[model samples]
Target chain A: MVVRGCENRSVNALVVEKQKSRENLFLIGVPCEGILDWHKIVSEVGEAVTAVKEDGQNLMVETRDGYQLLERADFLHDSCKRCIHPNPMSADILIGEPLPEGDPNLARTTVENFETQTIEDRYAWFQKEAERCIRCYACRQACPMCYCEECFVDHIEPRWTESGATPAGMQGWHIVRAFHQTGRCTSCGACERACPMDIKMTYLTEKLNHDMRDKYNFEAGLDAQSQPPFAAVTLDDKNRFTVRGE
Target chain B: MNHILEKHTLQDLLQSWRQDYDVYLPQKMENFSHFMPLTETSVLVDGDPHNTRIPPKALFLPMNEALVKFTRFGGYEDAKHEIQSRIVFGIRPCDAQAVQLLDTSFIQEDNIDPLWSERREKTITIGLGCHEPCQTGFCTTVGYGPFDRADLDAMLTDLGETYLVETFSEAGEGCFLGLPVASEEIYNQALDIQRSAHDQMPVAFETENLKGKLEQNFKSDYWDTVSQSCLGCGVCTFLCPTCFCFDIVDETQRRERVRNWDSCMFRTYSLEASGHNPRPSRVERTRQRLSHKYVYWLDQVNQIGCTGCGRCVRYCPVGLDIRAMLRQAQTLPFEVSHAA
Candidate 1:
């Protein structure tokens, strides 16, 4: 298996969950740059684009009209813009030159930007982004952590959320989807890039990731053996939701 | 009914109809263009001649809608949602054509869906021809065009500071009744613009024997190779202008029978209640999606199902181009399948 930073983390997490045997796996790891946003390129170059050649940090785009030189960094997807890790942490074989580590503050700013807004403003922003959802589940399908045989949304007898594109239904899908990735997310930004509506949702998961980091001093999938806060049971645990006479 | 509508006067004319109809036009969303209702402060999106991120089909079929409302004691009633008359102005020709194609499925004499039929009846489409056709679209190859007038009530040709409006119906003519009739010289200039715009689009694929090739090669390894990178996401079908499959669900909490958009690309779409999926994997799902458009639609309607609007080509997560797929399908050796 070929593993980038996110894919490597996903594999480690899966191994911890007993979904795969690490002994049987041979992972070829590579340093990552980032995934480019196709919409950004199409928006700038228009659909007349015949071909795009990725040469380092520059994109030589051939359109029906003429040629265009586009800066690759300018067109990176939002989640990739704030990536903290670009190199696979654990692999059997490491390939290519390791890229420079991304700053943690960039990911922090994304969470902070959403968290700083008023509760109503936060809800409004969420509502605006969520309303564009077609209930396609493209995000779930894109995520490596989301490998459930039958998804909760697909269940009929005990419907967890409204089975429509109404406001409530859409909101439930977004919130619950992020919640499922609480300690499992590798911050790949594949979900955001996969969206047809181009709805920004990594912020929600990033917020959960921020909370996991802050409360439990935990980061998911750093190694093959480290258990995530949500997955492991600890003797010393803190809880604000459930009443406990400690 | 050819007339000249000055650029400055277009907004006021749109505003005047607000008293009677909900006028929809493509306007700027966060980054891309979207179909938004005209308000007093609405500014029309311009500069790029491309289709909106969302197709106009949303105006008619909608992503989801309540078909029936349930009462306290198991009694059910028609949803009876009031649909207002709407003017879908500046709809692209490809999108407009898609609606007309969908009418065959939704509005057949033997079987009629009330929700879709009612919405279709209430909306009027006015097409805005693409002066510079989008790079991804291949309407010409699919027997449609950048300036197709088959389903539009009125078609507009961009003439710099003005629009050359050609109305095909009484309702379309009524919208621009007061506009001055265009002269022969101006009409000829508009024709030149339309022709040049049409000339810009290259035929994406050879439709000749393409359907036969796909139908014959149902079990080819080509499906596996092509569908390898596909994330099995619904991005392609959901964004598609012509893909109109939906699933009905009984929402007990909402007390309504709602219809939500479904896609063949979904594993669950073909999944039977007995824990068996007819189209088991992404390969089969991808084959169904492409074949339905290329083979099935042609067999049913004698016309290609895809409008070649390019939403699937543009929004595909894996960057799977249907144009490229169809062109590659042209190379596969044709053979008769016993099942066929």
Candidate 2:
């Protein structure tokens, strides 16, 4: 594998994971500004938007009518909005300035905003978003972590969820798909980018990543030597699975 | 017959049509405008005609449709299908052309798709001619234009405060009853506007020898470069005005056999039950998608599948431009390994 352009933490994680056995992997990282939020761009300027040019802070969108300007921060995707590692953690050669750090509490505030919402409101939001899902599995195909040959949603005979367009079926698919990436997801936003329906599924994975970090004090793909917290057997691990006082 | 109707009378005209046909016009949605059923609060986007974010094809071939129903003990039964008498207004010329392309495939001899044919027969298309083309649109290059009337029942051209209506069929002529007839001068002006609209559209490519160019580069390494950035997602296919691939599955729980929109981008799309796959990687899948538009459809239907609506270009997440791909393929040097 040869990575030649813009630095991404997901690419770093992938390299670290594969470099364990594959000695031929080479990574040449460059500084990344951020990935554009296409949904936000078209929404702000309407579907007739022509050329979208970006510098660092703003986007200039051209249309038949005229050109319109938009703030980059306001339109950035949730993952990109809170991205802390614009430079790869480990690289053989780096090309740009190290740069100032971003807001450390951005992820915390995002999770808190969702947490503050009432349970009913959250459920309603989840259901409404999930209802838009067409079971295309584009999200699954885009995510680097979703490599299972037989995803539970595709299993027959003892099917986890009946395959159809029903609301319940969509909910089952989203919930199960997100749960599978709980500790492994790198907050790469590829799944959300790939979704044609623009379903806001990153919230589920983000929330799960937060819980994993807070409970286990572990982060995924940050280091080459560290095993995934769930996969590792450690004496210091907490016993949350046991019955109370048993 | 040709007539001119004032902009203010549109509400009354739509109300009259509502009594007979389910009238749908371009209505602004969250991020884009699409043809939605005209309601009390419906408003056209400043009375401007442009391509909708979702193609008007949804009305004929829905995202999810039931083809057949089944019971465990009993055999299968045809799904209860209702054909609605409908009129879709403000359909852009490219989308209207896309419907004609679909007709060649679905309403063909010996293999007619009953549901699609029924809906198509009952639907009347009112095409809105674009005076100024959208940025991504390249309809003129693909043998259609902003003012093309090949597939429209009635064609409307914006003439300042009025819409110049030209009827091509009896069904279309019925719409101009009791309306002011367009003067010869006004008709002449409409013609000039259409000519300028055609001139204004940026020509993307000439398809005179597109099939030959594609055939020569079937096994080129160029596909590897194009497919690498692709996420293998269905956004391009789903938003496209002409893509018509579908998958039929037995939804046993619903007691129905449902047809859903499927993409060639998916790995499972070409997967075989015996663990053998022909289009195993994105390279082959990407080539198939492009070839289907530029090569195979011509062999099957006598017309290219792409209408140049440019929905795929604007909506692609990774910014994999199909226009760029086709242009690059024509010029890119490659060796022919084998026949494809």
Candidate 3:
């Protein structure tokens, strides 16, 4: 299995989880060069790219009229830029020379950048992003960690979220889905890539990942032996469930 | 009605038209031109007419449309009561013809779709003739051209500094108020531009024999091999201009009967309540898509379902090219029909 490191928490968790029962799992890791933001390319080209060829670090696109060149660095998904681990942390067979570590401050800068905005601005941004969601569950389907046979969104008995393409429904679906990933989200950028509508949904997961790292001192899928911080709790774990005054 | 509008004059016209109509122009956003509502800051990039990633089909048939709204207390109510009269400016010729094909699929039938027809009636399509057809589009082969003008009320041909406008319907005639008539030189230049655009579009394949080829090869293994790489995503059918299939889903709590766009590629599209699915696998769904577009569409609507916008070709996560499949389909040995 070619483990797309750091961003592939869902797959990593699954593989690690499987290791408890299954023994013969071999992992071949490849250093990720960051996934291309195809939607960015589509938007830049001003038309659907009929033909695409990658020449080194450049993407050559053929539209109806002519060719357009896009630098790969300019069109990488935001998660890829924030990804700290490109090479697999624990792989039996590692492919190619391990690349240098990504900027340590990338995740903090991204989180802080979004954090600097006012609550109203943040809400407005969320609403704007959520409104574009068609609720096709492309993000959910794209997620490797979202392996729930009966996703809460699909539960008609309790009905966690109403099945509508409205803004409120979209927001509910996204927030709930993103929350489900919590510590497990490896920031793989697959959900963003899989989305046909090109909704930038990784921001939700990335924020959660930042919080997990900050509060719990946990980064998911780094070690197979250790249990997920969220799953394994001790007396020392922070009990913030009570009201502040109480 | 037949006047040359200077390229700069278009901004003024659009500004004025924005007052009366929710004018949609192909505005360049991050990567592509989308038919978005005209804002004060909107700038038109007329160099490549094929710039818009998504077709203008959303003007009539929206991606997710609610058909009937029902509440526990208030039975059922019309979902889309307030239909806005809008103008879609700078839509490509292929997409324009695709809209006409949608009219055939939805409105021209005996039992016309109320929502589709209502929207179609209110919408005014001002087609901008493609100077150079998109490489993926084979509209010329599929009974249309860059400047075919199948059902466009108005057509604009780019003639360097000015646009040669021609009105085909009353709506087109009503769009202009004080524009001067085009000179003979301008008209000839428009004609030459049209001729060159038509010639520029390289036909990928001949569609004349496609229907026959598909009809004979229903059991062909080509579908299985082609669909092997398919992710079974709805990108193709959802983006297709003429695809009008919808799933009428009832929101129990809200009691609203919503008609969301459904794709045949999905397993649930053909699934029955009894747990039996007609299209159980990707192979069958892929075959159905090919047959529906290339074979059944001709029989039902007398037009190919695909306008060759190539959105499916470009957008498919798995890179499934219909043109390549069509080319492959052409080579398959014709199977003997039982009726024959």
Candidate 4:
């Protein structure tokens, strides 16, 4: 088992080669931090790294380690200081740094501030910023976590979000984005970064992250062994975050 | 410092700049205004204080950008489109920041756009401060003024007699190395002119509770009332400097693939191949437009997407004022329901 950082290309390639040898292999890559110039990175990496196109998501690598499946490090929320899934679902070899301890105090303050603010104020500011949205969906395309075969915004059957600049439609789009992230979101702030209008969508995710941690004491993508909150029902689970009757 | 560039010197500088970088400046093409290649023309930088009808993103992202062209028979064909290194001159601060905002959206993520990154990396932004703020300009209200230097590589402020050039990035400083520069006295005078212009600007909007208000009144009747007259002509999106939404379509023209701009304001904008129209009503479409910017975008990104350039407000045929709508959203009353 080989564990290293800044060896993403070689690690990914090794994982792919090993995948050919076996049905199941677990490989991990580092979580991308800050703003990245992907074009520059891809250009710099050159043709040695061939991006394997899956159904929708593509895995780019230089060599396979031993895993059939490759997992890139993902953020739990926008405020997360380290990659929650730095280690693979089950790995023979782990690449990149281990998960770092996050400042729960910062999360608490942010969540409290978010809770205190009236929904009306948030809505109004959202409308003001959304009014500038051209509906380019750049935010949707840029998010790694936003992996749906077809997004609701693109749905034609009932048309969840109309194709125009109406206030309600814009609100619906935002509500849907937040709802989808729920417990599953690793806030990486990628969506906000991708918006041409400069809409700070990360704040919304951060607010939700605070709720998940404070109320449920749950952190997403932190442990591969644990079942996701929405995915399982257990009597032993804490109910502080849930409604009483439900 | 307002030093006049003789028409001849300006042309020579443009030619020289073109040798090292792709020079982009405002050009009058037929009747409309756009940023085109100094690739061909002599006088590229025109002194227009009013925001360009089109944003500078169009120069890089383009109204019709080819993502990946492929033939049905051939598996996957690589579209080796290369963006040359360039300098965009005479751009306004609002536009420069708009580009920076775009950078966050396109460059800072797990899935980065190769095309956008290439163009952005090679491009040098030269911001020109608005000496005379436009009647519709209100960028100052939303944390950006005409002379804001947050996103510029270099800034050019117009003094009465000459232009004051201030470099903000290494690239910006490199651009002005051998060029004729104004004296320090002139530079100070340009600063004075900028201060006065900022004070003279009148449009302002309170953004303190903006996000909250929009969230509270998501289902308000105000949207219907305000958007009733909207023709959905989509001029606002097209003309907006920061509106970066586009539609991708595959077209075979003489065996070559082509794509073009698609506006969300159009009824057909969201119609899918499966015949599902999520935002069926004009009202719903209008609501989506507002909420995406105000609520969703803010929730997803960190900053307000709108730069207050007022192009949407100015060009709407129905005179649908986004600013006024935001103001109304902030003040609208709604029934509070306890999530019981």
iRMS of each prediction? 1.7, 2.7, 3.3, 17.0
Best by TM-score: 1
Pick out the ten consecutive residues of candidate 2 chain A with the lowest summed lDDT. Answer: A1-10
Clashing pairs in 2: none
- Say which docking band candidate 1 falls in: medium
Give the candidate number with the greatest DockQ.
1
Kindly list the per-residue Cα lDDT of model 4 for residues B200-295, writing each as its tens digit: 776566676777666776677877887787655556676665666766544343233434456667666777667688876668778877777666
lDDT of 2 by residue, A216-242 (tens): 776666655565566678676566767
Q: What does each candidate score in C-alpha RMSD?
A: 2.2, 3.5, 3.6, 24.9
TM-score winner between 1 and 2, please give it: 1
Error of 2 at A18 (Å): 5.2
lDDT of 1 by residue, A1-246 (tens): 999888898899888878889999999999888888777888788767888889989999898779999999998888888888889988899999899999989999999999999999999999999988888788988898899988888888899988878999899999999999988888988899888877999999998888888887777778778788788886776645477634
lDDT of 3: 0.76
lDDT of 2 by residue, B27-98 (tens): 865455767898877776774445887788888988777888885688888889777898888888899899
Q: Candidate 3 has what TM-score?
A: 0.87
Q: Using TM-score as the measure, what is the rank order of every candidate, best first?
A: 1, 2, 3, 4
Q: Write the candidate numbers in order of decreasing DockQ.
A: 1, 2, 3, 4
Reference interface contacts recovered per candidate: 0.78, 0.35, 0.18, 0.00
> Once superposed on the true structure, which residue ranges of model 2 sit more than 4 Å away at CA?
A1-8, A15-23, A38-72, A134-136, A150-158, A162-166, A233-237, A241-246, B47-50, B332-340
Question: Which candidate leads in lDDT?
Answer: 1
